[model samples]
Structure formats: C-alpha cells, structure tokens
Target: MIVAPGACRRLKPPYPYGSISISFGETLFNIRTDNFILGLTFLAPLAILFLNILLVFKVRRILFERKMNSSKKQRKSHISLTLTTLAIMIQHLASGAKTVIGIVRPELVPYALIIRHRLIDLGMISVPWIFYISHPMFHEKTARVSSFT
Candidate 1:
C-alpha cells in the first residue's frame, strides 16, 4: 500500500537561500527565499548550453574531417541536429534573459509576462517541427503500383 509516503515530510528542513543584493549607492534589489531556486534555474540552462556546444563541435568535426566524405544526408542530419540545439539554446537564453533583465532593470520586463512566454514558446514550437517532418510514422506510405489501373 503506497497510499501516503509522508516519511520525510515530518522532519523540519532548514531554509538554504541567501539574500541577493544589488546596490547602487542605496540597495536597488534585495530579496531572499527559503529555497535556493534561482541558482539551479540559471545553472541548469547553462549546463545544457555547455552540452549543446560540445554536440555542435562534435558534429562539426564529423562534417569537416579531412578523410570523411560529407554526403547530402550527413549534412542534412547535421543541420537538423544543429537546428534542434539552437532552438533549445535560444529557449534557455530567453528564459534566463528575462530573469537577468528583471534584476537589472525592473522597470523594463516587457510589461506582461506573456511576451516573455511567447518568445520562449516560439523556440519550443520550432524544435518539434523537424521531428514531425522526419519521423517515419508520420509520413504517408505510397503503394507501389505493380499493375496500372
């Protein structure tokens, strides 16, 4: 019976967040939270970006190596992989940029958060488009005509 596992919830956890302070003569921004969420949020995307850079470099080496024959299919595959990386990277950048802008210039956060959401959504929407076109199940299977009607 795995109905309720409140085994760890009974213990009181200590707050881990440290105050974020930015000051120009006087303090412009000073906020503190119980959880150190912002650090992870920022670092997670950064890690993805680092991985993306490595992937791109590896793909580039495969494409441009002296002895390797770079065919149309390989180029197309590389392009698709690069495009996917770019879409994901841009999405992460947009997400992180919003936070940085909010911290530096609180007045200029694009008014409504919907604008930021849309920018992020655009990147997310583009990543799947490549998959939709390339996936075999999604493509129509043409019947080979043995006898002409």
Candidate 2:
C-alpha cells in the first residue's frame, strides 16, 4: 500500500484500542509501533552513495592502469570519460545527501528541494553530451564526412 509522508508521523496500534498487548499465561508485554518508511527513506540514499563511491574507485583504477598504452585520441576519450564520471558521482552524492537530510530534518526541505531539482536538470542536459563525446564511432564518422565536404 502507498503511505504518505505525513502518515508516518502519527502511528496507530495494530489493535482496535490503539495499544498492542500480549499475554502468555500470567505474563504481559507491550511494544511501541515504529514507522518502517522512515527507516527505509534514510537508508536508501546512504546505500546509493556507497555504491556510487565504489563505482568511482573502480573506474579510476581502470583509467589509471590503461593510461600508459593509450594513444592521444584514446587518452582524450579516457580523460573525457573520467571527468564525466566524476561529475556524475558528485551530482549523485549531492542529491543523495540532500534527500537524506531533507527527510531527517524538515527545516532544510526547501533548500534541499531546490538543489536536488537543479542537479537533476543538470544531469539530464549533460548526459547526452557525455555519450556523444565518449563514443569513438561518432568522432570517426564525423571526421570522414567532414573530409568529403
């Protein structure tokens, strides 16, 4: 079921009287209700940030090891890829942190929302350019067509 953000603030007990009571012979136990969404909301962004960091390191290592043998054109492509990846990672981290902080602290919602929206817009615009610049075939075809013209 879909749960609203406000619904998480006020919790209702599983039972009718707004309290859960358990009895085993003469023993009695009571437990407080917790919002699962709040926990998941906080954890999701952290998980994404961790995965992004791992990806950054792997890409950096691969780029470093391959740099020595690559030609000028290949080196340029690698450098473009490296810069694009770093930019994307920074955007991801900023957005993730904004989300986590916005959820945990409502006071920062407006600022976080603005930052997140701008980051998303920036990514949308830059991704196509990154793909165009990184594709080796695109450059080769352009050069061939340009020579004919």
RMSD (Cα, Å) for all candidates, in order, is: 12.0, 10.5
Q: lDDT of each prediction vs. the true structure?
A: 0.63, 0.61
TM-score (C-alpha) between model 1 and the true structure: 0.61
lDDT of 2 by residue, 83-117 (tens): 66656655666666775786689677656766777
Local lDDT at 63 for model 2: 71
State the lDDT of candidate 1 residue by residue for 65-98, as single tens digits.
8336766656667766776777778777776777
Which regions of candidate 2 deviate over 4 angstroms?
Answer: 1-41, 141-149
lDDT (C-alpha) at residue 38 in model 1: 64
Model 2, poorest ten-residue lDDT window? 2-11
**Candidate 2: how many backbone clashes?**
0
Best by TM-score: 1
lDDT of 2 at 16: 42
